[model samples]
Target: MRKLVIAISMLAFAGSAAFADPILDRQALMKERGKIVGGLAKVAKGEDPFDAAAVLTQLQALQANAEKLDVDALFPAGSDAGDTTAGPKIWEDMAGFKATEDKYLADVKAATAAAPGDVDALKGQINTLGGDCGTCHQTYRVKKG
Candidate 1:
């Protein structure tokens, strides 16, 4: 009976790991992006000292993440069945989702090019980048509790 219970627990664990793999991967990606965005926001809000070099690094990281984001693969058919905040519209309206992703990438590219030299300039670029994030989230993401 103990052996049987152990086998069942192992099987359950394996099943859960398989189910959560994609969601965990996507969550990690989003968390990295969030950290970069949070730093940018702090600088923009004057909560942190404006370091141009750091801003450039963060922008570069953001741009790279945007480029690396593979929406289709990252968001597979059953990937959203877990604890994801992604809305059903992402899969339902794939074209629109792709368009929103493209817009965000474009905004990040533009912000990277702008490379704000000071806090004031950074604020404007942050606003543009943040707007892209806002628009995409509002349309494609569901708020989680």
Candidate 2:
């Protein structure tokens, strides 16, 4: 009886650990993206001086992350239950979710290629890039308080 209980406890712990790893990874990825956006926001708002080289580097990093982010793998089944801000609609309408992801990736790629030469050029691209971010968050993510 004691052995049975121990085994069950171990199995439950293992299951939860497996579930948690992906959630943690996804959270870290989101935070990294958020930091990149925050930097760009500072430049956009004139809180920070616009350095074209720095902005281009950040945009490249953003593009790299976007390219490597596999939405389906990051968001496995049952991931929406825990510490996640993802909405149920992501699993329900996976096609739409993927479409949104793809659009964001495309936008990032375009922005990276454009590589805005100055603050004004960067500002011009901000609307499109920010819109992509906002659209996905609005449609797919749950608001956290």
In order, how many clashes per candidate?
0, 0
Residues 1-145 of candidate 2: C-alpha lDDT, one tens digit per residue: 9999999999688546542466787787778898998898789889999888999999999997777567777888888898889899989998898998899899889989999888888887778878888988998899999
| List of clashing residue pairs for candidate 1 | none
Which regions in candidate 2 have their CA more than 4 angstroms from the true location? 1-20
* Candidate 1, 1-145: lDDT as tens digits: 9999999999688646542466786777788898999999999999999988899999999998888677876788887687889899988998998998899899899989889999999998888878888987999899988
Worst 10 residues of 2 by lDDT: 14-23
TM per candidate comes to 0.82, 0.83
Please tell me which predicted candidate would have the highest lDDT against the true structure: 1
Can you give the lDDT of residue 127 in candidate 1? Answer: 87
Clashing pairs in 2: none
In model 1, which runs have C-alpha deviations exceeding 4 angstroms? 1-20
